[model samples]
Target: MIVDHRIYTCHPGKLAAFVKLYEEAAWPLQQKYLKNCLGWFTTTEGELNTVVHLWGYDSLADRDAKRGAMAADPAWGEYLAKSASMGLLQKQENRICKPAPHYEAYTKAKG
Candidate 1:
């Protein structure tokens, strides 16, 4: 399986608001399309205004299809517009990860 790990950096003191927006707007949409979110996180010490989200997919094709569905949704478009208008996001970094052999996530995918 592959993990779509995303890191979103928000403007100073805007992380809470950004998270709230996601909760109110995008969270349900994600559940409908990308059903396997491993975790959503906010840092305590190292990175101050960043949110990390991990999504698990069976393969790249799975990720692509799910993300395409989400991207096509009108609700998703609305959320993006809201976020852009608010200027809550500063940067976005994404990493597509493959679990190494013997890892729990990898093993589960095999099973």
Candidate 2:
């Protein structure tokens, strides 16, 4: 599986608002278009106002298609606008990753 990780640094004091909008508005829209969307979460420790979410895809093509589908959805567009209006995030970073051979071992050890 492929994992698309998005790291968002929100403006100070806006983390709660961002999370509310993400859960109430954006996540539902994402659910409609992205069947492989694993989940969305935020960092509570090291980076205080950082959001990290992951989407799982069968392949690169599947990811592209799902994103396109989401973009085309009217509800998703509305949700995006609403979510964006909630707060201005300071920085955004996106990374696409595949599980490495040692990933399982690392996760097991961490667990």
Candidate 3:
């Protein structure tokens, strides 16, 4: 199993706007195409204005296929355009991870 972890740093006070837009537009689209979302989060103390979300996939190939389908959707394109136009985010980071031995069972169940 694999995990796609993403962090988005919003521009100063624009965190609320970014989160709102993402939930209203992008989240639905992602949920529709990528079925194994693990969770979504925001910082409470350190790294303020950053959002984090996790998605589980069966493998790298599965991740790529699901993401490709999402990218091909017109709604996803529109959401990207809207987010870019607002300039709500300052930076974004994504990481692909695999579970450690102890967590493998949990990942297998989730994935």
Candidate 4:
């Protein structure tokens, strides 16, 4: 599986607002188009005003296709517009990862 991790550093004092907007507006849109999305979360400590999200997909192509669909969705467009107004993220970073051998076994057992 492919794991997409996004780290976002928001402007100071905007963490709560960012989380609220994500949960109430952005998350639903993400769920609609990116079915492989595993989870979304924010940092409570260590890195203040940081948001982290993970998406699991069968392959790189699958991830790309899902994101493409999301971009094409009108609801997603509206969600982005609303969420963007919430706050400015100082920096955004994305990483793609593959599970370790142990993780594969762990995931299968969970399933």
Estimated TM-score for each candidate? 0.92, 0.82, 0.92, 0.83
Which model scores highest in TM-score? 1
| Model 3 per-residue lDDT tens digits across residues 1-111 | 889999999999999999899999999989899989899998988999999999999999999999999999999999999999999999999999988987887756777
Root-mean-square deviation (CA) per prediction: 2.1, 3.9, 2.3, 2.1
Candidate 1 runs further than 4 Å off? 104-111
- Candidate 2 — which residues are off by over 4 angstroms? 101-111
Model 2 worst lDDT run, 10 consecutive residues: 79-88
What TM-score, to 2 decimals, does candidate 3 have? 0.92
In candidate 2, what are the lDDT values of residues 3-103, reduced to their tens digit? 99889999989889888877887788788888666767778789889998889988889999999988998877887687677655888999999888799
The alpha-carbon lDDT assigned to residue 34 of candidate 4 equals: 84
Clashes by residue pair, model 4: none
Give me the displacement of residue 98 in model 3, in angstroms: 0.3
Candidate number with greatest lDDT: 1
lDDT of 4 by residue, 14-48 (tens): 77877877788778878887876777778888988
Query: What lDDT score goes with residue 38 in model 1?
Result: 99
TM-score of 1: 0.92
- Superposition error at 105 for model 4 (Å): 5.3
lDDT of 1 at 67: 96
Candidate 1 structure quality by residue, lDDT tens digits, 1-111: 799999999999999999999999999999999999999999898989999999999999999999999999999999999999999999999999987777966677778
